[model samples]
Target: MPDYYISQISHTDKTVIQGVTALLNAEGIRLDANLDYTCGMYDDEMNIIATGSCFGNTLRCLAVSSEHQGEGLMNQIISHLIEVQFERGNTHLFLYTKCSSAKFFGDLGFYEIARIDEQIVFMENRRTGFKNYLKKLEESSALQLQTLTKDTSANTATLQSDNALPDTSTADRKIAALVMNANPFTLGHQYLVEKAARENDLLHLFIVSEDASLVPFKVRKQLVMEGTAHLDNICYHDSGPYIISNATFPSYFQKDENAVIESHAMLDLTVFTEIAQTLGINRRYVGEEPTSLVTGIYNNIMSEKLPENGIECIIVPRKTDGKKAISASTVRQAIKDNDVDTLKKLVPESTLRYFESKEAKEVIERIRNSGNVIHY
Candidate 1:
């Protein structure tokens, strides 16, 4: 065994960065565009042997030279990246690796959350991370079921007075789910939720909790809750780094035009199967995507893959305001332009009033300062 050293690869240092890129390319891996830090493992001759990078809490673009296989260099690279994530206050970590490399990562204490077409495996540091997430989801489902049963009992008593015995058992309930980013909770989002809520026995609404969007997660969740307060059969859940998050779907946040949309969507829906099983979700609702190539591709993949997993993927036509389909992008553009009338037509009153209030001043400024508000 020869002595090897690991060190951070400064983004400004093109010479060392090129070496890292060449190494990753040689390993048939593209250097991810969203990395905040990259590090390389060098041999005694200062030649790059292994490399790994980090973006948020995710470890990505990892590779070990073919010639250096079984040299334990990858372990060193992973350990270094874990230390970096810990220093950045990211306790729970995640990574995406090829199916061939997943076993290696699993041996290093990572657990698989899902795999996409048997090509990419999404893994995390904690063993019970995904299990605990499923447990929490099941608990939420039980609580919602208990509430429904109680309501049904009261309704049953009323029906008994009328001499009509109706089936109020939850066994026949049609559970559905909808996943949304809802950057600012536009009317289109509300329309989708409303329709799903109307048709389903219980609708589990999972909001993307990542803060990578122009609108922060807290504000997005708050607006969604306020906008849909009229809906009674909704179990609101924060998608915590599990569903369509940076860990599961980095392309959603990075906005990489060249991203493999199908691959990302498959991984997300693969994990979504577990969530569906936990909550008895038999269907998923998504607004039809006519614009936004990335989301369009994602929806296409989802429509194809989810059905294969026993979950019906419903693509509801986008709600139109007598013109074009109302989109979050349009709402964001209206906000950027301060078009009050367009805002009134695009979002619910709660969302509109929030943007008008002082609390939304910061978020509005953030959106306005963002040069590009439309995602096409």
Candidate 2:
């Protein structure tokens, strides 16, 4: 056993970073280039022995050299990444790892959220996220649920309940749902909502409650509410931390991490499926995305997973302006380039009204200055 030290790596440390990638690749784990921060452990010989990377609060690409395995190097790397995230102001954390490494992290206080069989597993440091969120949501509807708690070994979690329970039934309405970011509430969003609302007796429009977008959740929610004011059957609600949240939305830095996109989508869709059953929602409508990489993958996942979970996912063709699809990204780009004519066509008139207001003027300015915005 030789002395080992761990430290953060920079772009200049290309050799060490490459070594880290090699170590991970050798272990059948692909290095996610989308990592915002990276760190590595070095032996006394200055040889990289272990490494890991962090994408916001979600840790990824963690690996240890074969020679260094079983020496607890993986724990050290995970600890470093967790501390980095904490210093960067992230309290909750998510990690995706190969099935074999699940227990290694599970011992470090990570709890399983979802798993793709033997392929991959998504875990969170906060064991109660889904249970707590579900409890809160069901509580809002006055429905009681048994809460889940981490087991004593921290190896797994189990569900628990008090002696009391709320009514577990909901109205048997012909209900559907749609989750949207509505970054600026474009007409495409309005069209999708209208179609869903027309067919279903009630439509639950979930706005991504995380302020993870260029536009804050409050402003985005307001625009969505105003734009859909005509839909009497539609109900707008915040997505909260459970659905498409920081834990699951993987386009962490305005770019796609293609490898983990589906994994992230699974966690979101899983929670959504649970919520659907609770609200008597049978179908979910989403505008087909033709441009954005992240949302397109999410829609595809919705098409595949939701039905299997007993929820129908309807992918509506996005409303097009001539040959082009209307998108929040297009609206943001138009605003950035000051293309008023094109921006007006993409977004609804109500959304445009906000673009002219003093408050939105500032938002638009920040958006224009911000580089590479993700369209939820």
* Candidate that scores best on TM-score: 1
CA shift of 240, model 1, Å: 1.2
Per-prediction TM-score, please? 0.90, 0.80
> Model 2, range 1-376, lDDT digits (tens) per residue?
6788888888567777778768777776666655778888888888888888887668877888888799988888888888889999998988777678799889999998776666566688998886777666556543112221112123322111111121224455457888887777998988888888777655777888876678888899999999987654555567865575643444322223664576677767776778887767799888887676767888888899888987888889889988788888888888888899998888888999999888897788888898865455
lDDT of each: 0.83, 0.74
Clashing pairs in 1: none
| Candidate 2: C-alpha lDDT | 0.74
- Model 1 alpha-carbon drift over 4 Å, by segment: 147-168, 246-259
For residues 1-376, could you state the per-residue lDDT of candidate 1 as single tens digits? 8888889889889999899989887887777767899998888889999999998889988889999999888888899999999999998999888888899999998999998655788899999999999998888767865665565576656433222223436476677899998988998999999899877767899999987898999999999999988766788899988886533354422224545676777778888999998877899998897776777888888888888888999999999999899988889999999999999999999998899999999999999999899876
Q: What value does the lDDT take at residue 81 in candidate 2?
A: 86
Q: What is the lDDT of residue 77 in candidate 2?
A: 85
